[model samples]
Target chain A: MASKLLVDIHTHVYLPRYASLLRSRTSVPFIRSSTSRDGKLDERLLILDHEPSGGRPVGPQYWDRDEKLQFMDKHGIDVSVVSTANPWLDFLPASQASTLAKELNEDLEQYCSDSPILPNAPIKRLYGFGLLPLVPEITTKSLLDTVEQISKLPHLRGLIIGTQGVGKGLDDEALDPVWTAIEAAGLVVFIHPHYGVDNKAWGDKDNGHVLPLALGFPFETTIATTRLILSGVLDRFPSLRLLLAHSGGALPQLSSRLASCIDHDPVVASRLKHDARYYLGKLYLDAVAYGPEELGFASDVIARSGRYQTGASVTGPAVRSLGSQRMLFGTDHPFFPPLNSTEKWKSVVENLDAIDAVQGWTQTDRDGVRGGNAVALFNLVG
Target chain B: MASKLLVDIHTHVYLPRYASLLRSRTSVPFIRSSTSRDGKLDERLLILDHEPSGGRPVGPQYWDRDEKLQFMDKHGIDVSVVSTANPWLDFLPASQASTLAKELNEDLEQYCSDSPILPNAPIKRLYGFGLLPLVPEITTKSLLDTVEQISKLPHLRGLIIGTQGVGKGLDDEALDPVWTAIEAAGLVVFIHPHYGVDNKAWGDKDNGHVLPLALGFPFETTIATTRLILSGVLDRFPSLRLLLAHSGGALPQLSSRLASCIDHDPVVASRLKHDARYYLGKLYLDAVAYGPEELGFASDVIARSGRYQTGASVTGPAVRSLGSQRMLFGTDHPFFPPLNSTEKWKSVVENLDAIDAVQGWTQTDRDGVRGGNAVALFNLVG
Candidate 1:
């Protein structure tokens, strides 16, 4: 069997500077320390946890880039397209947001540039998707300027964004300029979800991270993308490329249902003209789905949907050819950290297992999902 | 191509009596009419819709059994194991709850028994999963008695239940006797979701039934079943056969994540020495998934999990040799109604397409999902 390269496109890091900013805040997304049951001083960060308790312990692993490189080495990840973990700059003051975004992007860029500082660093090892300032009351001009500045950042490939846009959502018409600028800059939008659905949906019992991490994250991704689709983001910016986390977050499974829904509603149908399946070919998906069966199914759906777009003039063959290149490997690292004391991250291994398990897949296809896709999409190896 | 016998085990009906009850009540789950822009009466229902206009139109097709038969015939469904639609006697007063359940079960029995009254009706064509009077604070004795009474009804095959159990969820220890009795009677428990996750998960946008129906329904099913697993219902009632709607409502997709979570949490791991994947084969799934690839993937996951039990024994093959017997056909009728003008139900046909799409599946396997599974599980033909 040929050895295939493994890439982690969805890995997260809290830069040292970013961590300091979070520590200065009193609200959520902050870190603190508490007494453990063993009588040891344990640090805790409160992102989702609600209480007067200080946030979860912020350690060197969270902010230190060397720690990230060391962890990647431990996991056998060849190249990681790291991005800033949420809630990223959404709460910044408008005046300071743009400068802070630049600082964060530069900080990330420097980390990627210094990738070879560590010994035994794998070939073509480090790359990044930069962050954007998405605070409310921020002018569109400022947002567009940030996009332009980040586009030129040498190691920066794309921008990672949350679902909430200026407090409303991605659907708000005000954010169109941002989309247009990103599309014009030929940058992929790494759309991830932060604020999950209402807590009431969880019911009375505390299921720990089961409800939020398992359901909330994906559910939020699905809703956000659906809203964008309904609001005509694809129709408006046909060239816009979005890399959805968690294998399009149930979109492939629900695409047929969504298409049927559009077909049933005459008002929506007349306004939308084409079906939801039509837009699916244009969208890019990540192989963050846990199992190989899911990965294969998602790939099959992409392949089948690509067939539908064959006849369209401008978008037909280009979009179809992009099918294999459309999906990249993503590991939601530092989040689903191994609770078990294993040396290797189980989360990362399961994802690699999925890539290995996709049957009848050519080595080229395997290479594409592992590292080649990210290389081509983000121009990573240049 | 060989002709496949398509069975629909997931279909639902409101029944005339149930519709009338809804009409009488002014609260949620009730029906009312509002004047449209053209001054015409626009009927609506308020389960997901919260407007004062109330719920959607409660038509004859929702309640009338003959209409259901006609729908089945039109769709070429060989057999349908029908169940009452959601909010099934869940709101009845305590004193009258069980009596009303008896009345409804009797009505369904008569309907199935007298199917000869319909034109060109086949013998023993219609069977049902009966309703449980789950509301009004019934005693454990009465609940068990109700299960016993329903089992004795000739046309009744099993019991249909919602997530809520005496106001708490399925995990509540108080519901142990109910699960025990239902398992002992060899009656299949058709677990469905009525109350979706909180509406706050849905942002302020009228996507017109997209969020609740698409995401909420499946998410609710996943949560309820996870609770059951965490509470060790499957461990105790090994014989309990659960037919999950919506292709186990994202259970197949999230099983890996759930297993990882259990492995990570000491509290969860301490309770059960076995892995979470070991419990999946003990449960059964319905073919309500909208696509063929999804169905195939779901089946593959069940097969690979290696959790199947012969009876109550947890240690065995991951899946039984009776693969098709474990899954049944379902249409989810009365809901997802065709918005377009068409004689054939699109929802039913899509599911049929899924059944036809599963690769390498044999005719016997197809037959079992179509009708034979329901027949054996519910003892319908015998």
Candidate 2:
């Protein structure tokens, strides 16, 4: 019956209170009322659209628990590890960021605890990764305290963060306290990229959202994770488990090149003797790659680079160890929504097809990637 | 015993006059002289150095024709279709740019005519791709006139161009005349990236040139080609041939996503009903990917995207009709110099190894990529 163990670690949702908070604001991340040609008032979120034409139609799917359950049931997802969508608490005032983070975490925990709103909804199938208050000027103490608070949330498994950290970047040494705290808390840092590469890179800048979303997002993830690798953050925090969005954002394909560049650089080599390939294994990647070939390649890269042992001859165990447990399924919902369609979301289906087509993948591996791995990794089930 | 038909479509060389011209300036693309600690005068070209530390030591290998023959022989390369390296003539004074380009083209043609300095060097194997002055203020007439003149150079195959055109980008409408002339001349445009994506994308404004070279170069190429695709250039000039560096700079992996974005966009869909995948088969990607797996994936993409027809399906005929003449091989020499060894250049060796690793690639296909394809595509042999 197709395992029926499918888990989506990449899905996103906007809770009711969060939606209300956005509707009350006036700037980015806010919803505004605009009159349609038919003269009806419509609420639009101005996140993507620059003009005053009300942002994309926001509906119950964004905020209502029933809709989330319905979508999961229709997609045959056994479990959905949801997280608040992008621009998450990043715009909140520094003083209010922490308190709001706490409230959101508690509210989300309550939602997960509540009964399934749909009949025949899969049992024990809802969990979430919480958000962090990362606005600039927030005290490191506050950030650390928030981490401490999130660590104790019964349903919170990890923290979702954007590329900008304290407004410098992920490479900033100032972020060491936060990294250390997150590592110490045994929480996975789900690293996603919100701010893409500079807009000038898009050239004459007329392709609309294609450049930023298709290229910018993944490229940003690649650069941020590369900075982390180059800065020796992985070495310092060996236990730091990073979950990269967009399937490690080109990291799997570029890992060899990264290693080659490091090997070729005198300065980089003098400080680090370990292979760059070794660090890739240390990081866990979500299976959000769009196709089976890409998924196979990502899996093969992890298998080859992360193998646990090495011998002198050609025949030897790999030096690092990773298994299907290291991978998780995700659906980058809310974003990449089906355009001009009322049928099933193409984005979700493509991802599901990728899982279906993974070559030589055992039932255990499939199960683990689908739901079992995330369940164990995030403690999704009680 | 090995294929003596080896061709290098990607090789680069800087002419002596051009080197001298750079030596006279103080800005980027100029040469600088400094006193070394040993009190010896050191002359260096600025292209290799970021902070202008007396620039990089310029040697005969960079400017001397005999040295080019020697390197080609040492590396077992039979024929080399060389072009002027990056920052080509994009910075020239408008009045002087076209004239200088004419002179350089003649100089290269004369050099190719008098080659074979090495013992038993292959006959008629050295060819050149001329340079164009693409900076702003240069009239489209001047650009067209230069192309017309170079079109008659027996050894000139095409023009090597950077991303910038008339200070806007490749997508600028002003480039249409230039493209039309080149397409009419049947010259294959070698598209390379010089100015990388903004340096700010690399973060901290420091970390040396690693970020730009390692990340920015490919990112720039990807954006430029995407702009060309998005601007309807392919549809406008279906006959124009383009060779992209760095295996299309992440385009293969992102093509699916690009197609999906276009499929979903109302603006893009309203104008173009064809899938983005259709255009990829028209683009010619060099085999400079750094590894076997990458090469395999690229080759697989070519086959899957219907760029490589094998009599297996309908897409195969379209790919086949495009001709085996479409794809070519290149060595981005002098740029990625061997880091720390006196051994054969690792960059060249790695590329060669990648060519060797692509499984089931026939000798015909192999020879074509090595040199025959470029020879036919550019009409290199007379």
Candidate 3:
């Protein structure tokens, strides 16, 4: 049997091309120079409005492949499935979106195909999920063209997309062809959250980006993913291969409740082919949710999803076998850099430790989450 | 040892006075006669604007106490900690709100104390969480007056409240006194979801009440509860016991993610006295989340909360004793009544079976959840 591999499927990166575009812009997704503690000008990524901390500090780790490889080597990560971080062309002018998306996709492919070797590392183990042009007014043909283009990129296993699809949401019927094209190409759709919940929902208080990132991001993912299920997205496109960020963004936990609601609601009962729980195996969840119990709970829920119709009453013990196979280890680095500059990134450390601490997880299960699943799902041979 | 009790803590009802108020109103919370399938006039309770299905059908189960006792007898529920269902007095006029709240509290108390003996039943077992006048116009004096009155009610354990406190939200500082007063009296605050989420989040579609009930209610609960924790409400009122509807409304699942977000964000980290996970034990989550995996997952998360800093690295197995003790059985009766009149409610059966099906759960845990916890939480001594 092959030895266990430590794969980071959820780490993110900004390409030089995208960074250049952001540096020229003055909007929320733009990059600006801010004075640091030492009174030196430092690059900051302002991705949201009224950001209390004046946005996060942006460094080489964000756009530098060397930094990503160094960080991966430092953390013993065998492979990094990189993707474009959020605010991905969503703010671009429609006319420029497709062109920029194509460029960004090429940039990512180039990054993945790079054979750079670090001093202490054996090989450059980097693959990426490309970006999509979801800005309004982009032609469907152009969108499908981008998908076709990304699919042909040998190193690109999948692509990341924000909640907004064709300017509505993932549930929008207009994205049917987009979904079909992606499924046809066998590319895993990484459903990442960028635009959090509405400001009004955040209430009149300013807790900085805590509410938006923590509550807003997951809540957005939950609503969008649910909307897709509720709108029969999964039912219509059975093998769409959707992967949600942030440990399915509360989906694993809320699925039973969502299923119960659907069963009880007359409008949805007839519409859905199966309960929400049945779709748990139909989707993949990135292991970015922090803490051992959190990840363990999510794994258990997804495992239950694999055996939705288990004759538990007669069988006695319930069977759950899908979670580890579907859960891919992710670091979500660059963002959430360590508070102490010299220390290891807490975000990465916490996520890795969480998997290590997960009770009942076998060595094989850990290996599956670490790399085996990503290898199978994304066809990452190396 | 005393025989284990089966208490339903999350069940709901509408008293005579509250029903009359709904009938008199012409808004979302109003009751109106609608033609049914059999060509008979059926009283429909419209709790939201343009609600499809013309609102749920109102019957004896909603407003009649004798029917409640009979339902309890049939279901083998030994005690019930009932509360006024959603949209409770939240829509009343200011001057009338306080008065209506007092009257409703009295009515609930009377319902709980009623000693009706049914055939094959040993006791008239019913306890209740009272109502509060939460309209904007109600003064602090009136709010405290209602709290003071309910605290004095022997049978009323706590009170049910919507996510909206004083029309702003639970995070509103103005409600500090309200939280303090409720805490001071040792009333277990049952935080229920009434006004679902802003419709914008639901998008341009209608799937009946599934969006609101499944996603909206829980989403609302998650946000409101998180806000309370974010605003340091739990830190201020350490002893306050808060019970969240629908198993903490996505709280247990999203909690770890919420904590991760907080740690990443400096503003929240500096502002919050504790991480989001720390509050899991501080708040009580009902097992309204169906499926053993779902309930078990919730219980597991809550149990983790009880021992946050468990030297789990040294301790081979994680200790999780907090969930069952905190998880009180709930029917959510009348709302998700059986679609077919003659059959047992799918809602009730599913919930009960879910408890019975929880993996690794002992008979003691089941009994405790079924009634023992409520018996202790509400001090519902017969």
Best by TM-score: 3
Docking class of 1: acceptable
Model 2 lDDT at residue A53: 31
Per-prediction RMSD in angstroms?
4.2, 3.9, 2.7
RMSD of 3: 2.7
- Taking chain A of candidate 2, what TM-score results? 0.89
Q: Where does candidate 3 clash, by residue pair?
A: B7-B370, B7-B371
Q: Is candidate 1 or 2 superior in DockQ?
A: 2
Docking class of 2: acceptable
Q: Candidate 1, residues A236-341: lDDT per residue as tens digits?
A: 9999989888877667666666766665555655656366766766777888877775676667667656444436443221122235567788878787677654
Q: What DockQ values do the models have?
A: 0.37, 0.40, 0.66
Q: Which model scores highest in DockQ?
A: 3
Ten consecutive residues with minimal summed lDDT in candidate 2 chain B? B315-324
Q: What does TM-score give for chain A of every model?
A: 0.90, 0.89, 0.93
Residue A309 error, candidate 2, Å: 9.4
Model 3 ranges with Cα > 4 A deviation: A1-3, A34-39, A117-124, A309-321, B1-3, B34-39, B117-123, B309-317
Q: Give one digit per residue, the lDDT tens place, for model 2 in B1-382.
A: 2234677888888898888888788888887778889998777777643542345566767778777777777788877888888888888888878888888988888877776532343346688888888888999988898899788987788888899987899999999999898988988888998887666677773555566666777777888888888888877888898988877776666666676676566686555435665666677777776655555455545555552222334432122212334556777866666765366777777777766655446667667767667656766545
The DockQ-based CAPRI class assigned to model 3 is medium
Chain B TM-scores across candidates: 0.89, 0.89, 0.93
Off by over 4 Å in 2: A1-4, A37-39, A48-54, A115-123, A306-327, A358-368, B1-4, B47-55, B117-123, B307-327, B359-368
